[model samples]
Target: MQTSPENDLVTIEEAAAMLGTTTVNILMNLKRNLLQGQEIDGHWHVSKASLAAHGGDTKAAVSKPLCQRSTCGSCGQH
Candidate 1:
């Protein structure tokens, strides 16, 4: 992936494009508290770090486990 300076504050639309997702999806993530953001100028803003850490999907970072599950639903096999 190309590295470019990101806007200090990015809107849902811009984030969605950068993350290769839909605005609705991004919005949902924000609503579910899956993504880290702040309300500035009456708009939500996401950090570049948050996006990069989650592979553009912050929810996946927290909700999904590192390993595939065969026994334990949250992570690896028992």
Candidate 2:
């Protein structure tokens, strides 16, 4: 739950794409503490750092800041 501007958080779908996996697997990983993420407004936001550390494809993750996304109401902190 410790989110800061330095930590780029991606939505579950984005994380799945970065890791090349399904959202369900990502959710299980999050619950198992195999990944680092936080739940925000009923949605799961995965940590880009953790994803990269776990060998995920960083290039596949969103290049722009999450704040720029249309669904920024819940992720405008960045």
Residues 1-78 of candidate 2: C-alpha lDDT, one tens digit per residue: 444333689887877776776787678667767678988778898887878875435433322333355763424554
Clashing pairs in 1: none
Deviation in Å, model 2, residue 17 alpha carbon:
0.6
Residue by residue across 31-75, what tens digits does model 1's lDDT show?
Answer: 666676777767767766667778645455544542333543434
Model 2: pairs clashing at backbone N, Cα or C within 3 Å: none
Among all windows of 10 consecutive residues in model 1, the one with the lowest summed lDDT is 66-75
Q: Candidate 1 regions off by >4 Å?
A: 1-7, 56-78
Please name the candidate that would achieve the greatest TM-score relative to the true structure: 2
lDDT (CA) for every model shown? 0.61, 0.67
